[model samples]
Target: MSTLRIYISNQCPSCATAIHRVHFVRRLRPEQSVELINLDHQDTVRPSYVFGTPTYCLGNQIIFLGNPSEGELLSKLDQPLSSVKQIT
Candidate 1:
Protein backbone atom coordinates (compact mmCIF):
# COMPACT_ATOMS: atom_id res chain seq x y z
CA MET A 1 0.00 0.00 0.00
CA SER A 2 1.18 3.53 -0.74
CA THR A 3 2.22 5.39 2.40
CA LEU A 4 -0.02 8.16 3.69
CA ARG A 5 1.07 9.06 7.19
CA ILE A 6 -0.86 11.50 9.34
CA TYR A 7 0.75 12.80 12.53
CA ILE A 8 -1.76 13.92 15.10
CA SER A 9 -2.70 14.05 18.75
CA ASN A 10 -6.09 12.75 19.87
CA GLN A 11 -6.88 15.85 21.94
CA CYS A 12 -6.38 18.32 19.11
CA PRO A 13 -9.31 19.63 17.12
CA SER A 14 -7.25 19.84 13.97
CA CYS A 15 -6.23 16.22 14.41
CA ALA A 16 -9.84 15.19 14.81
CA THR A 17 -10.75 17.14 11.70
CA ALA A 18 -7.93 15.53 9.78
CA ILE A 19 -9.03 12.05 10.87
CA HIS A 20 -12.59 12.63 9.77
CA ARG A 21 -11.42 14.01 6.45
CA VAL A 22 -9.14 11.03 5.95
CA HIS A 23 -11.95 8.62 6.74
CA PHE A 24 -14.18 10.43 4.27
CA VAL A 25 -11.55 10.09 1.58
CA ARG A 26 -10.97 6.45 2.45
CA ARG A 27 -14.63 5.69 2.11
CA LEU A 28 -14.86 7.56 -1.14
CA ARG A 29 -11.65 6.21 -2.59
CA PRO A 30 -11.20 2.72 -1.28
CA GLU A 31 -8.27 2.26 -3.62
CA GLN A 32 -6.04 4.54 -1.57
CA SER A 33 -4.42 3.58 1.72
CA VAL A 34 -4.36 6.07 4.59
CA GLU A 35 -2.41 5.52 7.78
CA LEU A 36 -3.06 7.56 10.91
CA ILE A 37 -0.04 8.04 13.17
CA ASN A 38 -0.76 9.32 16.62
CA LEU A 39 1.83 11.88 17.64
CA ASP A 40 1.13 11.40 21.32
CA HIS A 41 2.36 7.84 21.05
CA GLN A 42 6.10 7.48 21.65
CA ASP A 43 6.68 5.13 18.69
CA THR A 44 5.28 7.50 16.11
CA VAL A 45 6.82 10.67 17.54
CA ARG A 46 10.35 9.30 17.42
CA PRO A 47 10.17 8.54 13.69
CA SER A 48 8.47 11.83 12.87
CA TYR A 49 8.60 14.75 15.28
CA VAL A 50 5.31 16.47 14.63
CA PHE A 51 5.50 19.91 16.25
CA GLY A 52 1.93 20.65 15.27
CA THR A 53 -1.21 18.70 16.00
CA PRO A 54 -1.95 17.75 12.44
CA THR A 55 0.68 17.11 9.80
CA TYR A 56 0.36 15.02 6.62
CA CYS A 57 3.15 13.10 4.96
CA LEU A 58 2.62 11.39 1.69
CA GLY A 59 5.24 8.67 1.57
CA ASN A 60 7.64 10.30 4.03
CA GLN A 61 7.24 13.65 2.25
CA ILE A 62 5.16 16.22 4.01
CA ILE A 63 2.64 17.71 1.61
CA PHE A 64 0.40 19.63 3.95
CA LEU A 65 0.34 21.27 7.35
CA GLY A 66 -2.25 22.47 9.91
CA ASN A 67 -5.92 21.71 9.29
CA PRO A 68 -6.71 19.14 6.68
CA SER A 69 -8.52 19.88 3.45
CA GLU A 70 -10.37 17.45 1.19
CA GLY A 71 -9.48 19.44 -1.91
CA GLU A 72 -5.77 19.51 -1.08
CA LEU A 73 -5.69 15.77 -0.52
CA LEU A 74 -7.44 15.05 -3.78
CA SER A 75 -5.21 17.43 -5.74
CA LYS A 76 -2.06 15.57 -4.75
CA LEU A 77 -3.49 12.11 -5.34
CA ASP A 78 -1.78 11.94 -8.69
CA GLN A 79 1.54 13.60 -7.82
CA PRO A 80 4.61 11.41 -8.11
CA LEU A 81 6.50 10.56 -4.92
CA SER A 82 9.03 13.28 -4.13
CA SER A 83 12.30 13.07 -2.24
CA VAL A 84 10.60 14.06 1.03
CA LYS A 85 10.84 17.78 0.15
CA GLN A 86 11.14 20.08 -2.81
CA ILE A 87 13.05 23.36 -2.56
CA THR A 88 11.33 26.00 -4.60
Candidate 2:
Protein backbone atom coordinates (compact mmCIF):
# COMPACT_ATOMS: atom_id res chain seq x y z
CA MET A 1 0.00 0.00 0.00
CA SER A 2 1.02 3.60 -0.64
CA THR A 3 -0.11 7.01 0.45
CA LEU A 4 -2.24 8.60 -2.26
CA ARG A 5 -2.59 12.26 -1.48
CA ILE A 6 -4.71 14.50 -3.66
CA TYR A 7 -4.61 18.27 -3.26
CA ILE A 8 -7.84 19.96 -4.28
CA SER A 9 -9.43 23.38 -4.25
CA ASN A 10 -13.15 23.98 -3.81
CA GLN A 11 -15.39 25.03 -6.72
CA CYS A 12 -12.84 23.89 -9.28
CA PRO A 13 -13.80 21.59 -12.13
CA SER A 14 -10.27 20.32 -12.40
CA CYS A 15 -10.34 19.40 -8.75
CA ALA A 16 -13.46 17.33 -9.36
CA THR A 17 -11.74 15.51 -12.19
CA ALA A 18 -8.81 14.69 -9.93
CA ILE A 19 -11.20 13.41 -7.29
CA HIS A 20 -12.79 11.12 -9.86
CA ARG A 21 -9.42 9.64 -10.72
CA VAL A 22 -8.70 8.92 -7.05
CA HIS A 23 -12.05 7.22 -6.58
CA PHE A 24 -11.54 5.20 -9.73
CA VAL A 25 -8.23 3.93 -8.43
CA ARG A 26 -9.76 3.23 -5.04
CA ARG A 27 -12.60 1.23 -6.59
CA LEU A 28 -10.15 -1.08 -8.29
CA ARG A 29 -7.96 -1.40 -5.19
CA PRO A 30 -9.90 -1.11 -1.97
CA GLU A 31 -6.92 -1.93 0.19
CA GLN A 32 -5.06 1.23 -0.86
CA SER A 33 -5.41 4.31 1.31
CA VAL A 34 -6.35 7.69 -0.16
CA GLU A 35 -6.35 11.15 1.33
CA LEU A 36 -8.02 14.27 -0.06
CA ILE A 37 -6.30 17.41 1.16
CA ASN A 38 -7.97 20.72 0.65
CA LEU A 39 -5.40 23.29 -0.48
CA ASP A 40 -7.66 25.92 0.99
CA HIS A 41 -7.30 24.50 4.48
CA GLN A 42 -3.92 22.81 4.37
CA ASP A 43 -0.49 24.31 3.99
CA THR A 44 1.14 22.02 1.47
CA VAL A 45 4.90 22.06 1.96
CA ARG A 46 5.51 22.64 -1.73
CA PRO A 47 2.97 24.03 -4.21
CA SER A 48 5.24 25.90 -6.59
CA TYR A 49 6.04 23.16 -9.11
CA VAL A 50 2.59 21.63 -9.35
CA PHE A 51 0.75 23.24 -12.29
CA GLY A 52 -2.73 23.38 -10.81
CA THR A 53 -5.47 21.72 -8.88
CA PRO A 54 -5.83 17.91 -9.07
CA THR A 55 -2.20 17.28 -8.40
CA TYR A 56 -1.51 13.72 -7.23
CA CYS A 57 1.28 12.59 -4.97
CA LEU A 58 2.11 8.97 -4.34
CA GLY A 59 3.95 8.84 -1.08
CA ASN A 60 6.29 11.87 -1.17
CA GLN A 61 6.70 11.87 -4.95
CA ILE A 62 4.35 13.41 -7.43
CA ILE A 63 2.81 10.83 -9.73
CA PHE A 64 0.59 13.12 -11.76
CA LEU A 65 0.60 16.80 -12.41
CA GLY A 66 -2.81 17.12 -13.99
CA ASN A 67 -6.02 15.20 -14.41
CA PRO A 68 -5.30 12.02 -16.34
CA SER A 69 -7.31 9.00 -17.43
CA GLU A 70 -7.80 6.37 -14.77
CA GLY A 71 -5.54 4.06 -16.76
CA GLU A 72 -2.61 6.46 -16.80
CA LEU A 73 -3.17 7.30 -13.18
CA LEU A 74 -3.17 3.63 -12.27
CA SER A 75 0.17 3.00 -13.91
CA LYS A 76 1.91 5.60 -11.75
CA LEU A 77 0.18 4.28 -8.69
CA ASP A 78 1.07 0.71 -9.55
CA GLN A 79 4.75 1.56 -9.33
CA PRO A 80 4.46 1.98 -5.58
CA LEU A 81 1.59 -0.34 -4.77
CA SER A 82 2.15 -3.80 -3.38
CA SER A 83 -1.04 -5.09 -5.00
CA VAL A 84 -3.29 -3.70 -7.71
CA LYS A 85 -6.03 -4.89 -10.05
CA GLN A 86 -6.80 -3.28 -13.38
CA ILE A 87 -10.27 -1.92 -14.05
CA THR A 88 -11.76 -0.62 -17.25
Candidate 3:
Protein backbone atom coordinates (compact mmCIF):
# COMPACT_ATOMS: atom_id res chain seq x y z
CA MET A 1 0.00 0.00 0.00
CA SER A 2 3.01 2.27 -0.29
CA THR A 3 2.89 5.19 -2.68
CA LEU A 4 5.63 6.22 -5.08
CA ARG A 5 6.05 9.94 -5.67
CA ILE A 6 7.82 11.15 -8.80
CA TYR A 7 8.99 14.77 -8.75
CA ILE A 8 9.59 16.09 -12.22
CA SER A 9 10.16 19.40 -13.94
CA ASN A 10 9.27 20.47 -17.47
CA GLN A 11 12.75 21.81 -18.12
CA CYS A 12 14.45 18.48 -17.45
CA PRO A 13 15.13 16.48 -20.61
CA SER A 14 15.18 13.20 -18.69
CA CYS A 15 11.93 13.83 -16.86
CA ALA A 16 10.01 12.29 -19.76
CA THR A 17 12.00 9.12 -19.44
CA ALA A 18 11.30 9.07 -15.73
CA ILE A 19 7.61 9.54 -16.41
CA HIS A 20 7.69 6.66 -18.86
CA ARG A 21 9.39 4.51 -16.28
CA VAL A 22 6.53 5.25 -13.89
CA HIS A 23 4.06 4.16 -16.50
CA PHE A 24 6.00 0.99 -17.04
CA VAL A 25 5.86 0.34 -13.33
CA ARG A 26 2.15 0.99 -13.29
CA ARG A 27 1.53 -1.49 -16.08
CA LEU A 28 3.49 -4.16 -14.29
CA ARG A 29 2.30 -3.35 -10.78
CA PRO A 30 -1.21 -2.15 -11.05
CA GLU A 31 -1.74 -2.18 -7.31
CA GLN A 32 1.05 0.26 -6.63
CA SER A 33 0.03 3.87 -6.08
CA VAL A 34 2.08 6.40 -7.99
CA GLU A 35 1.85 10.18 -7.83
CA LEU A 36 3.47 12.53 -10.30
CA ILE A 37 4.43 15.97 -9.02
CA ASN A 38 5.43 18.56 -11.57
CA LEU A 39 7.53 21.30 -10.01
CA ASP A 40 6.91 23.61 -12.92
CA HIS A 41 3.32 24.01 -11.79
CA GLN A 42 2.80 26.92 -9.45
CA ASP A 43 0.43 24.93 -7.23
CA THR A 44 2.96 22.19 -6.70
CA VAL A 45 5.21 22.57 -3.69
CA ARG A 46 8.75 21.33 -4.08
CA PRO A 47 10.17 19.19 -1.33
CA SER A 48 13.23 20.51 0.48
CA TYR A 49 15.30 17.40 -0.17
CA VAL A 50 14.59 17.28 -3.88
CA PHE A 51 17.32 19.39 -5.42
CA GLY A 52 16.82 18.24 -9.01
CA THR A 53 14.22 16.95 -11.38
CA PRO A 54 13.18 13.34 -12.01
CA THR A 55 13.47 12.45 -8.36
CA TYR A 56 11.68 9.30 -7.25
CA CYS A 57 10.59 8.93 -3.66
CA LEU A 58 8.95 6.10 -1.83
CA GLY A 59 7.19 7.58 1.15
CA ASN A 60 9.43 10.35 2.50
CA GLN A 61 12.73 8.83 1.40
CA ILE A 62 14.25 9.48 -1.98
CA ILE A 63 14.97 6.33 -3.96
CA PHE A 64 16.47 7.86 -7.06
CA LEU A 65 17.62 11.34 -8.00
CA GLY A 66 17.33 10.93 -11.77
CA ASN A 67 15.98 8.63 -14.42
CA PRO A 68 16.63 5.06 -13.42
CA SER A 69 16.59 1.84 -15.44
CA GLU A 70 13.24 0.05 -15.49
CA GLY A 71 14.83 -2.98 -13.88
CA GLU A 72 16.37 -0.95 -11.08
CA LEU A 73 13.13 0.84 -10.42
CA LEU A 74 11.14 -2.40 -10.35
CA SER A 75 13.67 -4.02 -8.08
CA LYS A 76 13.43 -1.19 -5.59
CA LEU A 77 9.65 -1.24 -5.71
CA ASP A 78 9.60 -4.94 -4.94
CA GLN A 79 11.70 -4.62 -1.83
CA PRO A 80 10.62 -3.35 1.58
CA LEU A 81 10.97 0.38 1.97
CA SER A 82 13.38 0.01 4.85
CA SER A 83 15.70 -2.15 2.80
CA VAL A 84 15.69 -0.03 -0.31
CA LYS A 85 18.64 2.32 -0.40
CA GLN A 86 18.69 5.75 -2.01
CA ILE A 87 20.17 5.76 -5.52
CA THR A 88 21.72 8.71 -7.28
Candidate 4:
Protein backbone atom coordinates (compact mmCIF):
# COMPACT_ATOMS: atom_id res chain seq x y z
CA MET A 1 0.00 0.00 0.00
CA SER A 2 1.18 3.50 -0.73
CA THR A 3 1.57 5.97 2.11
CA LEU A 4 1.57 9.74 2.42
CA ARG A 5 4.07 10.89 5.00
CA ILE A 6 3.69 14.40 6.32
CA TYR A 7 6.60 15.99 8.16
CA ILE A 8 5.89 18.82 10.55
CA SER A 9 7.75 20.90 13.13
CA ASN A 10 6.30 22.53 16.24
CA GLN A 11 8.07 25.81 15.67
CA CYS A 12 6.84 26.34 12.11
CA PRO A 13 4.12 28.93 11.83
CA SER A 14 2.38 27.09 8.98
CA CYS A 15 2.56 23.66 10.57
CA ALA A 16 -0.91 23.92 12.12
CA THR A 17 -2.55 24.76 8.82
CA ALA A 18 -0.60 22.06 7.02
CA ILE A 19 -1.69 19.48 9.60
CA HIS A 20 -5.33 20.48 9.28
CA ARG A 21 -5.16 20.15 5.51
CA VAL A 22 -3.62 16.70 5.80
CA HIS A 23 -6.36 15.52 8.13
CA PHE A 24 -8.92 16.80 5.69
CA VAL A 25 -7.21 14.90 2.92
CA ARG A 26 -7.23 11.76 5.05
CA ARG A 27 -10.98 11.86 5.35
CA LEU A 28 -11.32 12.22 1.62
CA ARG A 29 -8.93 9.42 0.82
CA PRO A 30 -9.39 6.55 3.23
CA GLU A 31 -7.57 4.10 0.99
CA GLN A 32 -4.32 6.06 1.27
CA SER A 33 -2.34 5.71 4.50
CA VAL A 34 -1.30 8.93 6.16
CA GLU A 35 1.58 9.23 8.61
CA LEU A 36 2.43 12.36 10.55
CA ILE A 37 6.00 12.81 11.72
CA ASN A 38 6.83 15.55 14.16
CA LEU A 39 10.40 16.67 13.65
CA ASP A 40 10.46 18.32 17.05
CA HIS A 41 10.80 14.89 18.59
CA GLN A 42 14.43 13.90 18.93
CA ASP A 43 13.74 10.27 18.04
CA THR A 44 12.06 11.06 14.73
CA VAL A 45 14.10 9.79 11.79
CA ARG A 46 13.68 11.43 8.39
CA PRO A 47 15.59 12.04 5.19
CA SER A 48 18.21 14.77 5.35
CA TYR A 49 16.55 16.51 2.39
CA VAL A 50 13.39 17.03 4.43
CA PHE A 51 14.58 20.23 6.08
CA GLY A 52 11.31 22.17 6.02
CA THR A 53 8.06 21.83 7.90
CA PRO A 54 4.89 20.71 6.10
CA THR A 55 6.79 18.49 3.74
CA TYR A 56 4.68 15.83 2.04
CA CYS A 57 6.22 12.60 0.90
CA LEU A 58 4.86 9.74 -1.12
CA GLY A 59 6.89 6.62 -0.88
CA ASN A 60 10.55 7.73 -0.84
CA GLN A 61 9.92 10.97 -2.70
CA ILE A 62 9.13 14.42 -1.42
CA ILE A 63 5.94 15.49 -3.19
CA PHE A 64 5.31 18.92 -1.74
CA LEU A 65 7.55 21.33 0.10
CA GLY A 66 4.80 23.22 1.88
CA ASN A 67 1.05 23.31 2.31
CA PRO A 68 -0.85 22.56 -0.90
CA SER A 69 -4.41 23.48 -1.74
CA GLU A 70 -7.03 20.78 -1.30
CA GLY A 71 -7.75 20.49 -5.02
CA GLU A 72 -4.09 20.38 -5.96
CA LEU A 73 -3.25 17.86 -3.27
CA LEU A 74 -6.16 15.63 -4.20
CA SER A 75 -5.25 15.73 -7.85
CA LYS A 76 -1.75 14.57 -7.09
CA LEU A 77 -2.92 11.85 -4.74
CA ASP A 78 -5.49 10.55 -7.18
CA GLN A 79 -3.06 10.19 -10.01
CA PRO A 80 -1.79 6.78 -11.01
CA LEU A 81 1.47 5.92 -9.30
CA SER A 82 3.33 5.84 -12.59
CA SER A 83 2.31 9.39 -13.35
CA VAL A 84 3.54 10.86 -10.10
CA LYS A 85 6.95 12.43 -10.46
CA GLN A 86 9.77 11.23 -8.26
CA ILE A 87 11.42 13.95 -6.17
CA THR A 88 14.16 12.79 -3.88
What is the clash count for each candidate, in the order shown? Answer: 0, 0, 0, 0
Off by over 4 Å in 2: 42-51, 80-88
Q: What is the alpha-carbon lDDT for the whole of candidate 4?
A: 0.85
TM-scores, each model vs. reference: 0.77, 0.73, 0.92, 0.90
In the range 1-88, model 4's lDDT, one tens digit per residue, is 5688999998999889888877898799888899889998999987887989899888877778999888888888888767777764
Give the per-residue Cα lDDT of candidate 4 at 53: 89
**Candidate 2: residue 32 lDDT (0-100):** 75
Candidate 2 per-residue lDDT, tens place, 1-88, comes to: 6688888878667888877777887799788789887777756564565556777877656667677788887777667443333222
lDDT of 1 by residue, 1-88 (tens): 4677777887887777888878887898788888887867767543534567687877666778876568768767666665347423
C-alpha root-mean-square deviation, each candidate: 2.9, 6.3, 2.3, 1.3
- Tens digits of per-residue lDDT, candidate 3, 1-88, equal 6799999999999998988987898899999999999999999998788999899999888989888899999988989987866544
Which pairs, if any, clash in model 4? none
Q: Lowest summed lDDT over 10 consecutive residues: which window, candidate 4?
A: 79-88
- Model 1, stretches more than 4 Å misplaced? 83-88
* Per-residue lDDT value at 2 in model 2: 65
What range of 10 consecutive residues in model 1 has the weakest lDDT sum? 79-88
